[model samples]
Target chain A: MSRFSFNQITAKPWTLPEMVAGCVAAGVDQVALWREPVAEYGLDRAAALVRDAGLRVTTLCRSGFFQLPGWFDDNRRAIDEAAALRAPVLVLVSGGLPEGSRDLAGAREHVADAIGRLVPDAAAAGVTLAVEPLHPMYAADRCVISTWDQALAIAERHPAEHVGVTVDTYHLWWDDTVLEKIARAGDRIAIYQLADWITPLPAGVLTGRGLPGDGCIDMRAFHDAVDKAGYRGPIEVEVMNADLWERPGRDVLAATMTSFERSFRGR
Target chain B: MSRFSFNQITAKPWTLPEMVAGCVAAGVDQVALWREPVAEYGLDRAAALVRDAGLRVTTLCRSGFFQLPGWFDDNRRAIDEAAALRAPVLVLVSGGLPEGSRDLAGAREHVADAIGRLVPDAAAAGVTLAVEPLHPMYAADRCVISTWDQALAIAERHPAEHVGVTVDTYHLWWDDTVLEKIARAGDRIAIYQLADWITPLPAGVLTGRGLPGDGCIDMRAFHDAVDKAGYRGPIEVEVMNADLWERPGRDVLAATMTSFERSFRGR
Candidate 1:
């Protein structure tokens, strides 16, 4: 059997250390660390303790922007931090369209150029930059990579070991060619993540996500396809919903494990 | 410039005849006719009067099954109706994923098979089949084809000279490959529909579309690509805002024309 990782979207209540412990307790063997938790503790110490914990660090939470200033330097710094942690993938979500620009094509170009400048640092750090295409509802303020073909094309343009894509079903279940793209992406895929899609989206992006089976997503088929696509890497449960973050850490991790198992049953 | 047909999503106050007349008055030369309005006026008479008005019918509003019995036969009847109207395209929106099945892949397979069976009939009548991939949020209860690639695959399955994909911005603006697919589709794209995506989706999908320039879409860049892609078709302004429908019919059409012009900036 293959191992999987789970990332806690928030580090509140029990802190990152406690969440890490909680995930271990829940039978999860790997983790993708986020930025806030690293910020709370100094990076070196956090890396040391995680190494001591006997758990694997699969990927770093993120770094990307279409409209933010100082993004380039910030991204370089993020690569150093990820390198320190020994994580292989750094998630890159291209921030929303620029203010008053109304030019999505321009925004996409900005993201490409930013990646072009930063991929060298990431490559040196031995980290793969994974461009994450967020849901279309988030096109305004979240991310511009909304489909797999676009993500694949971007990754293909870079064509390096350090540049690839993270395919998350929550963000991509609604896309048309997701399965086709997954099969085509083959080994260049960086991360395979899962979250559920729920309606009446809570009036905010951060809180609308549901646990794997709590909502409408058919995660079993997704995992099956990912496995079929030759992606044998960790299937990370990356739930960003504020509701899940607010829940008891142990219960949340336990429930997510159950959902993950259910999603991949005999797939 | 070539004259084109328009599809007014809501035809209130003015009645069907007057709506067609209003579109013609506003320089629209053809139309994508919906079945409900014609049913309200009775079919044979509606057909005769529409034919008499010298307005070309571009597409029929819809025909598919979310979870109904006899879905194939029902949609076959819709194809027959399109034939009667001598419409160039029959818009087939794959019914929503069934209530019990979260199997989106299964739903897509059903859609492809149904279209496969109907392609011969569609070809015999000289009616092209345009598969409309709805917005993802509608996956639960509307059409399941949510990207250009998916629609293209479905079109490939049928391979009828008359089968192609319909690109509606309201349903597809969130996609990353809109320009690429529009260009790649070349002659296979029979229709390109338009609507602006605004936040707080007005509580339901039946309405809540914005006027072209009122939303955040990069309409002009999209325009340049579509034009550069060699699509010299008429820009069909199809808005489904409740607020717009509540206004005077003349007011809605007038505003849509103004927004359409602004959206493309007369390029």
Candidate 2:
């Protein structure tokens, strides 16, 4: 229970203030924030609100579409926002191949280079750039970094504090070898997140994630691996489902917490 | 284009006779047939129709749902069907985990054991059992064999003449290490298939494939790898697109042939 954190995206419609208050009321000590709502509610005010309520910001949701124009400036601003919000990590979902492009190898090379370029800014702002490997299904339209090995390959080139990898069960549970590799990742594991893989993926294949225990993933394996890595950080339940989004934020948080408890029970 | 084979699933709505006639009309010499429609049209009759037309059956579409009850008998029947059609290879899509179970490793072991149990029948019938590794997205509900390594690992334990792996571009393009491994696979490469990966996958994700030139797969890379592996066999175009299925069988075959020609044009 001490490690549980509710990622704001789990309740997609919840504003920063409302998410903070809901987490506080639910007795969750930490919350992970997304950039859009934080900017919508004003970064400083949102930071102050969470701080005043005695909640720790686990991570900033994301900021890495490196394939797009203005990626450098946008990512630099994201680093600044992360620093201002007192979040230790900024998740990076490397964008897919450029439009009309079939060069996945080239896109991946560009991601490695782009992350190399962002390291100084992140280090200066004191925020870890967590490279997240989205599922291979998303390799075409979302993120080309689609495996634990790929994420670690890029992050190993930088200092551990400046660049790291994210461990999200939803994006990685299909992999047979990821658990053992993740167990040895140590400090390179920037943030740990949980989302179960459910069937009948939606059209876009983005928001069909299940709560921790609602699907077939063996969450205890992930928990054991992260523990073996000596990670003592927030375990954020970051599911994104249309049905979950329609519910009230408090209800979603409560459900997420219950799911987390269920997943971690008897451990 | 002597090596080109048009898989029947590319024209989903075409009947067994209509598909055979259409393939003959398109000047196609070889085809890969699925078990469902072949059974519907009477396997023996369907075999005679294609055999009389002098069309060689490249491979049988499938036969490996090891998780189901009666999988052994069903697979034996599939092997008989392949023998009747004179198809050299029987593609195996190892079924997903059982109901309410999350033991992926156990499921994979069951598939290997099930295949081992069927190897004698396959060898006696002169049908090569080609284990197919589906895209990892289908790992939960369709096939547990989700990577080149996993497929190859199981196949290596059996005689190369009796068991091998199916390399489909759509299922494997995202893998960085597969090309080199496939290049070294030698005679263990049983069937080579092509289908491009397109964006915005449809619901269920079973019928969202693209024609060779319609999406992002590099057909030439696959060609080169298989060539280096000393494979000189039929290259079946096995795309399952909803829009393509809506078209007439003749039109679909023409378009698939054109895509195949374009993909292999300069190579």
Judging by DockQ against the true structure, name the best candidate.
2
| Candidate 1, A52-135: lDDT as tens digits | 787788888888874798898889988898899999889998898777666776787788888888888988889899998887
TM-score, chain A only, candidate 1, equals 0.95
Q: What DockQ score does model 1 reach against the true complex?
A: 0.29
Candidate 2: CAPRI quality band: medium
lDDT of each: 0.76, 0.93
**Tens-digit per-residue lDDT, B195-258, candidate 1:** 8877665544457778788787767766766676666665677778778878877777788777
lDDT of 2 by residue, B22-82 (tens): 8888789999999999999999899999999999999999999889998999999999999
TM-score of each: 0.82, 0.99
Best by TM-score: 2
C-alpha lDDT (0 to 100) for residue B35 of candidate 1: 72
